[model samples]
Target: MGDRLLEHEELLRELAAVQDWPLPKRMKWAKRRRKEQFRHWKRWIETDEAQSKCARPRKNSNPPDLKFASEIVLLEASARNDVDEVIAFLDEGVDPNLTNIDGLTALHQCCIDNCVDLATVLLEHGANVNARDIEMWTPLHAASRCGHLVLVRLLLEHGADLVAVNSDGQMPYEIAETSAVLLELQEAMEKNGFDDGAIEDARNSGPLQMLSDVKELCDRGEPLSLADAHGVTLLHIAASNGYTQVVECLLTNEAAIDPRDRDGWTPLHGAACWGQYEVIELLAEYGADLDAVTGTDETPTMLASDQNITLLLHDLKTRQLERSARNKSRPRSRTFSSSSRGHSVKRDSVNKKSHFSKRDIAEEGKQFKADADSTTGDVDDVVIGSLDDENGGNASESEQSVFSTDSAEKKALRRSKSPPILIKTSDPIQEETEGENNGSMAQRDNVVQAALAPSTLEGQDSKAELVSKETPPLRRRHRSENTSGKCCTIL
Candidate 1:
């Protein structure tokens, strides 16, 4: 065998026969069978039938380590005022609105550094001019405070709200360091179509001094919704000063009643804080939101010092509850629901009223039948004829059948049903579909909710609770020793 291996063709044959030597010696027959099968498979694979099933491999797949770096690159370029670099990154699909660790967008940083060209580039690339930082400070605020007149003009021209306040309750104009920047902001605001005269009148003087001028402007078809540098609207000022007619005039011009100032103070909140009972009543009458909470989560009643003002708010709340209860008791005939967008007309009450007698409905049905006959090719007769010809010839019978079905539907609609009050229970109880002669357990749940409604007085400590005569009070310093005047004085 060694002598035969010396020849290349002889060595190949010998190697192929002994290729299965790793197999068990007892399974030598099985190895011979496998070798024969392998030879057949190799021959088949070379044919077209086997070649058609194989697919060509793909190339240049995305690798796992490719990280996103365009935002950081764009931010660095913008900060350094490298216009070309910034442009290159932007062209390569960097987001202009991408914010940094401090929530400062490219536009904000450019304005801070007074980079007018960079700001223009970022704005043209679709950066938000009014984008607020983490502190809620807009680019306009930064530009004005930094005394960049040109950048301030650019921001105002792009429709930035000058009255927008930061988290610290400071507007752009309020933080402006120089008169030149403030004057430019005012001019830009006016040129951008603000009510400059009304705004100046509202900001420069009290409501008593400026009411006539504001009314004249309102007469000239000028809007009264302009806000001052402190984000206080003309209506807010009027409400704060207890100027009832001014408030009414502003409302007559369709001014918003619940516009909030920088500190989340609405007109009602200002009225309550100043103990303006008349303004509070007027605002409540105009449907101002009574449950609105301030930035500190204080309600109007919680901020009022005068007990009368607090009592007025409570009375208004009680009246509102009574009105809602009355409206729920009656069957509404028609309701016109007015909203900010538009008013909607709903006629559910016409079908709900049960006062119409059977005789009246019969007469109305006869009148409807007469009208249907007057019109050519009555729809019901045509449909009945197509369905069953024998029933179609009797038009009166068909009309009567239709009228009777409609009367049945109307009667069903006339049956009024009240919604059930759902009550959660710690222990599951059997559902009671009918009410008892007196109060049910569900009524107790509603009473509990009513008692829990918040209406705390101003300067009252929330941590203290009412104590019974048997319970001991916490130790405290003597009232005479407390010069802070914060001690409670019981009547």
Candidate 2:
């Protein structure tokens, strides 16, 4: 058998054919060999990965030891409380930092299972002692809540955060129900120099506070953008936790938006990673950069794992693109809209702007037209009377010529006699026809403005001055007309 390598299948068949090696002997021998093979592969992979992490050159090694048919998931191994399997997998280059679907790391699982040995091994391999799961729960939270005293001590000694608040605003010590666990946490806190007052102060300062807490801080005139030791600001905490009102308060108070935490994660990054949908939308509204990268070079968009969050980002991106495009082409569109009519006008340039809605403008236009015609008629009658006075009630041929003229000529005279009220407005008949064809209120206003265009900028300036001078007189007239002696709203 030493002369050449025998396949495992062939070896199994040979063992079966052997009379000396009975069923019990074969089973014992196979178990011993499997353990030896597993141990050998574990050590080799462990060394290679550790060296790689240290930036050292690697040596050629055997492909993964397929001693077992397949490797179990790291989470599954920890959940099963299989210390050997967990260690084997960890040794074979599975990252202790890798999380399952619930964002639970192997350390988290170890704490949940109360597996002190597994937790120790994972920590030795550099598992984060304070790794927060999806609900912002640390391993200490799991162990403390499960009343696993050994696991709690192991985690605390490994530097687990005692006062790290979870999604429900409960800390590890707060959740620690057993007297033993509570006493241990309290002792740890005292040893670490954390006092009751200090803990309470820290908790109050956190962005996870209620609106009333925020209001209290505001009353005290305390600074809004409070940061912890890790440089996590109130915006970061509120955003990650989906506290919309708190986030809005922080923002309205002019708190820093893009402040990065210890890991270069902004509030947006935290919100996206934790699947805070409304918070993500709120951040986008506040102009949070979608492309801001973390220390690991991952963007908020890349960190977003939820379907709704991705959809929200997609919509925000679409709106941003549309807004940019609209802004870029606004001047051109405005220019085109102003000149859509046949005539030229400078409506926007006028100083005395008539702020009127569609209905108000139409009503004012009709009312003004009637007033202008009445004024024209009065002025024409005065001129005709003065001509008659000049001729002394004369029967002169020129005076008689007016009445003798054709009806068309008389109508032309009356039309020409009116002030230039309709100069800015289109012919009423033409405007009606166009309005019927195209019912756009904005477009019709543009046409009126285009026709009202002054011949030159100098002319426009004179028109503005004239309108300014005329407005006070118009208002005075309306006020005098009011029998109640109250100021009339001269529209």
Candidate 3:
């Protein structure tokens, strides 16, 4: 019998090795061999069954090893939704709390999969509700992350810790996306007398403060370094909201100008990304570093768009230039080493001017100023020139002089004329000296100063000063006119 079995095995192995055997021939031979093997196994089983029935074996099919049985039952029960088979096994001596290699129990699987009914059954059967997986995620954490609001509420009501953090340091509420579910879980926790100290910490950390509080601090001139629960400063909050006034107030108070948040975002980055041009300009004016990189290695200037943030950036560049000129005027005995030359070159390239004729512009400006002075008396007919004169002198014909118009006509010409040829030149040396002079003269004009002042007590003083200096003669002329008209009528 052993020899016949060996011969059959040899034949099967030889047939398997046939590279070019026809499919029909291979199937026929394999079928015959399998039939013969089945016949032999049937005879052996029948003989054994007869003997086993006669003797009655001591153990019924040798119960699986206790540990292996426990592991298999646990794995199968946790993976499948049907709990009947799992419950039967548990009743038959399988441990309900058996953890796999990852320390995940059946309850963890049920919660993660949102099998609320199965989870309830498991809990009733004494499964640990707070059993943690490999990531130390409790069943409540799994339910919250899965957005199972009912399961989350159930778990919380049953005394699941609301503030328990997973390996990722996120609480159940932090992971939950649905506001309704989060609120329900929170309410359930409160009903169960569970306190979320972490949430209270976040609220008290100034994140929940009224806009008035922020404004009051700004009004009272309080700094913006006030840290919240997560160590985020008031600048961080104001920047996130793009609150221009709040940001301006915080900046004026000398807030930590560019302190990075936990995510390494400075106020300038937030302002730039959110298209808050006013806030961005305020931040830049207060000495926020444009070149400073975020945690993602993106600079504020890199994130700024030409459409939304161009004006802000242009203003920043202008201020930077003004600041550089100011600093240059101050005596600095420090010598520039060779290594520092590269950094200086890079800085200068950022605001480089295109090739243009400043001399021609200066000549045009002189001509325009001479024309302006000559036509001041007849300013009503004096036309201003075009920014681009190459367009066939058409715009030059429209250039009108301001001083040539009569007082009544001048009052009608109260509208501002073109920006006064002052912004056309690119030379910082010339721009600083000339622009400063013009700006200072404009500042001295009390009427212009009063018009620019904010409507406050400070503005009222400015308005009074302006009235005394420039408008007194006009006021007197009106009074004289009224007096003369009254006297003539009486006569």
Candidate 2 or 3, higher lDDT? 2
Q: Give the top-scoring candidate (TM-score).
A: 2
Ranking by TM-score: 2, 3, 1
Q: Report the C-alpha lDDT of model 2 over 132-223, residue by residue, as the tens digit.
A: 88688999999999999999888877788878878766788899969999999999988988887878766655564576687788788898
Candidate 3, poorest ten consecutive residues by summed lDDT: 482-491
True lDDT of residue 219, candidate 3? 76
lDDT of each: 0.66, 0.69, 0.61
Model 2 spans with C-alpha error above 4 angstroms:
1-111, 115-165, 168-208, 331-491
Q: Could you report the Cα RMSD, in angstroms, for every candidate shown?
A: 42.1, 23.7, 29.1
Best of the candidates, lDDT? 2
Best-to-worst order by lDDT is: 2, 1, 3
Worst 10 residues of 1 by lDDT: 457-466
Candidate 1 vs. true structure, TM-score: 0.29
The C-alpha local distance difference test score for the whole of candidate 2 amounts to 0.69
